[model samples]
Target: MSLGSRSSRRHHRALQHRAIALVVLASVLVACVFHNGASNGSPGSIPSDLEPGDVVHPSPIPGSTDQTIELARTKIKHIVFVIKENRTFDTLFGRFPGADGVTQGTTCDGKTVPLLRAPDRVGDQLHSFFDGITDINGGKMDCFAQGGYVQYLPQDIPHYWAYARRYTLADRFFSSIYGPTGIEHLWTFASQSDHFIDHERPGQFGSASREFCDDPLETALAFRSMARQEQERIYQAEDEGAQGLAQIRASLTSRWPCFDVKVLPDLLQQRGISWKDYRGENPFVQPLRMVRHVRFSSMYRNVVDVSEFMRDVKARKLPAVSWLTPSFKLSDHPPTSICAGENWFVTEMNGLMRSPYWSSTAVILTWDDFGGFYDHVPPPHVDLYGLGPRVPAIVISPWARSGFIDHDTMEFASVLRFIETIFDLPPLTSRDANTNDMLNAFDFTGRPRPPLLMRPRTCPAR
Candidate 1:
């Protein structure tokens, strides 16, 4: 009886062991599949298997690794990226030809408004993190006026309008992030942002939008107060020594989640490419002070004032890559006249084109984020950061296709992709790696065109 019972128990144990072995083998097979796919260095995932909302965005324009490098080395020599404050594609360029702009917007109360024809000047609405989430409403594309409805006309922004007519206007471009000025500006340099959503205005999250609606005058006063506080925070340790600032930064990082990461300027330096970031205004509108990378890096010395860009252009010492920031008055942020921004842009672009660098230059002018304005198209759910509302983008270069409208799906990272591919540098993250690089907006195979002239409709009163 003892031998028989022992044999039966041993047999039962063997069967359990075999079952566990089979489960382990199956798990290994799945891991191998994923690992191999990732190792292949293929682009995004296969799109067919996913649901409608769930999408995998790859480059809209196609080119091999070598082909991209060749284009960069042979055809282009300079890439100038201009960053403006809160503005939507519809609000700025809804009436543009061959864009997915909205003429009509559905209000939050189920009413419709003529977005194409808006006021001479619309009041500023809340464009904070909470405001963006409430406005999108899970991609229904509703609640624009409720959020803050304002569409601009050609008369208001003649320079931008005329520029679109002459060169390539990208209608389907997005902000890459659904955050306010500070966060979007971070994306302008770094493709990603810290965990912090709003710029630095942590206190005005839920109430910023409501307060704007309740009392416009009071909101104006409150915003000015907040701006002063943020500017102070941005430059608290500007004059501190390295060790002193490091200690202050330790405290600041704990209080503010100012995570450190690499940016476009880093890649440029590693590849022996020269670059510059032109900071123009107060700490609030400036690029160098907004992000931790520029504040700490040796590249911070490259952070010259805005006047330097013009000086370099005239001297023919312009770097390979450049980013220019505008003042509050010239940024076209609400409450400020678009005329000032319009004239400022025209003056800047005309100066560049008149320079010898114009032939080899590619000037990409785009807004920072949709400044609480209405757009009909809803943004897709990409990741925790965002692919916020549509914003107007222009491609002006000798290689840029003339009278073209790029309808491809793209974001701010697409610009980064272009620079990386051109410079033959490695990608910073998965996001920029998947960007289309707006290749279709360009035609290196074609003959180079002469610079298109521009003029302001009327000089803005300062």
Candidate 2:
């Protein structure tokens, strides 16, 4: 009990203090990393080891430089967006030359499976949001066998293949969100989905006869909680016990299918830019119908039948922007005739090419979701929602880089960014604001290429 004992005690206290300081510093650094990631609208939990193909890299500014924006606006006056049904890039163009597609896929049981030649009418497989996550299997991309593993040859969809060979084919384009038709359609119009993760459930959402706002008032759609803590909980809950998973899912929020959020059409309206939503026989595919403003107001008139698309082209009444959707039979959805879908697509493109609008029009043809098909690429995790499986996208225009294969990592928001850039419209959400503007797909200074019309082929006898 002297000076020596007192000095030893002081040294121990100092060492403990230093340990506490180091712990606090480590905590602050971890918090900063998450804050920076979430500040940019990306998932705070993104793995540091994600591949380049597994990330959505934004352009330097919002939409590149002023010169690029000016060039886009000057060269393009009209954009025809033809969104078909669920078909992954590998499902349609897996064997196409120079495309990032695969002829084989891995299964959940660690077995390789060759992609069988899919018929014009293969059976449909499960592709719900939950199913999409299961198929991804935490980026292993090996659970498509849980759904189906099939691919179509060029002969099955001659027109689509021909279009890719003649125009710009984007092999790395992903769906804005995970599967099912309705939610992806919503993402097409609005980059944000109001946190909704899936389509309306059958019994939980009333009669399920319709998926739009016109459905029964009691109907509600389930949405994931975007709260940072909730996102982390759910993200980690994937491999947890069934009871834990159920508890997490039960904590999810829900709302009516109708959303009041701002969409691209609202910006177009503000700018006095003309646009139309040309719907095919299917009523549920029309996304504008789910918006309260468009559904209950005078803007509803802009949503018309698909037949009117060609009529408007022939009459020179095509609007500045057009969204075209096809019916179930021609949607290229499984069990539907792929030939029929290709033929319908060719007919529309042919009509546009022959019209005077062809000179200034840019036609963007793409599928909505993966449609339970086998795709080799894993979708990059952007947020709690998605940058779902890779899908086929074609940019057809006189200014399009002919026969080019673009491997840029993009989603539906990229298309929105392009339209917003060309029209000088503001982005509706962070997803679109930070996405690529798709300027790489075009050559504005090069000579405008002539249209290469394709002949529709007859469907083979089943």
Q: What would the TM-scores of all predictions be?
A: 0.74, 0.85
Local accuracy of candidate 2 as per-residue lDDT tens digits, 133-198? 778776678877444788888877878888898889998788877677777888888887776665
Clashing pairs in 2: none
Model 1 off-target regions past 4 Å? 1-69, 203-254, 290-293, 459-462
Number of the predicted model whose lDDT against the real structure is largest: 2
Give, for candidate 1, the lowest lDDT window spanning 10 residues.
46-55
Stretches of candidate 2 above 4 Å error? 1-44, 47-63, 202-208, 224-226, 238-248
**CA lDDT of each prediction against the hidden true structure:** 0.66, 0.76
TM-score of 1: 0.74
Over 139-202, each residue of candidate 1 has an lDDT whose tens digit, in order, gives 5567554536667778777778877877789887888666577667767777766444554434
Instruction: Indicate the residue-level lDDT of 447 in model 2.
Output: 91
